[model samples]
Target: MKYLNALRNQWIAARGWMFCTLLLAGLLIYVMQSYVQLSANMPTRLVPYDLHLMEGPVEVGASAGYTDEDYLTEIAVADTQLHSTWTPNNVESQYARFQNRMTPALYAKVGNDLQGRLPDLENSERSQALFVEHTEALEDTVRVTGRLRAWIGSEQVEDRPIAYRVRYAFSDGVPYVAGFSVEEE
Candidate 1:
């Protein structure tokens, strides 16, 4: 309390220029901190993949039985958008960073399953998707099976091939994944 009183007395006795400078500096710091906090909560637009970057299969198709091309196209776009956000070949320490980068809409499609599969996909260098196979279709629920070559290291694990079976349903015209599971191929 004594120190604060002394500082206040000193500030009042200081020259006008010094007092104004100190006041401006304090105000500047407050504005910058507020701006940083505001921007931190806002969603940022980031494109992880290069505009001309091309990797993996150009076409994604199922084993058979899928007739809806529009749905397949949507699935491909979502997969491509999300895959580009996965952590690069750094290490397990940086592997889970991709989950934080996903936008709310993008996250809605695969949030449940993808979040759980981060560990398995940590070392995935790349994949060549066979295609999206629609196995079950109902009024609201649709099931899609995806086959891809998951490369961990230099060696490709193929003996127990894995495929994702995602179940999707529409809520107010927006499709969301109810759940997903990996099936052995």
Candidate 2:
């Protein structure tokens, strides 16, 4: 009876603290329940624009059945766009992004070569933009032809025809860049 009395007295003294603890626990439960409801109501598949920079259907990686001419054309255009568009300040970032689309072997060869050119590109203050003229998709290869406009410190330096042919290796329809060649026309 004495021990119970002591515990009762202590609990009375700590009632304010207990009330705060209970309030916080209730708030935490409410927040968690609200989160669960919100998550449950959310869509399972997000729209393409939500996850990608370009607006189109959400691509769920490459598939053998889906590797059609249209797919090759899309890949070619995207590759060339990343390859040919760069400013002095953005060249490094652009190349880094481009690396994601290449095979390990290709990246090892090209990436090291690109690193060597980075200092020159940075120092030159050059920018280049491409306007696509034509794109042809063939078996295992895609060619993108465009007009390339170069600028040196806001002054237009050169504008000419450029073409890039990218060869791809597909393993079960997942494209990995094998190699590429550039031609000036």
**Predicted structure with the largest TM-score when compared to the true one:** 2
Question: In candidate 1, how many Å is residue 179 off?
Answer: 1.8
lDDT of each: 0.49, 0.82
Cα TM-score per model? 0.37, 0.67
For candidate 1, lDDT tens digit of each residue in 18-49? 97899999999999999999999997543335
- Residue 184, model 1: Cα distance from true site in angstroms: 3.6
Candidate 2: segments with Cα more than 4 A from true spot: 1-66
lDDT of 2 by residue, 1-185 (tens): 99999999999879978999999999999999999999999967534434557565544334443445766788888888887899988888877777888888899888888778888987887999989989987777888998999998889999999999998887644787888889878
RMSD of 1: 11.8
Question: Candidate 2, after superposition: displacement of residue 170 in Å?
Answer: 2.5
Clashing residue pairs found in predicted model 2: none
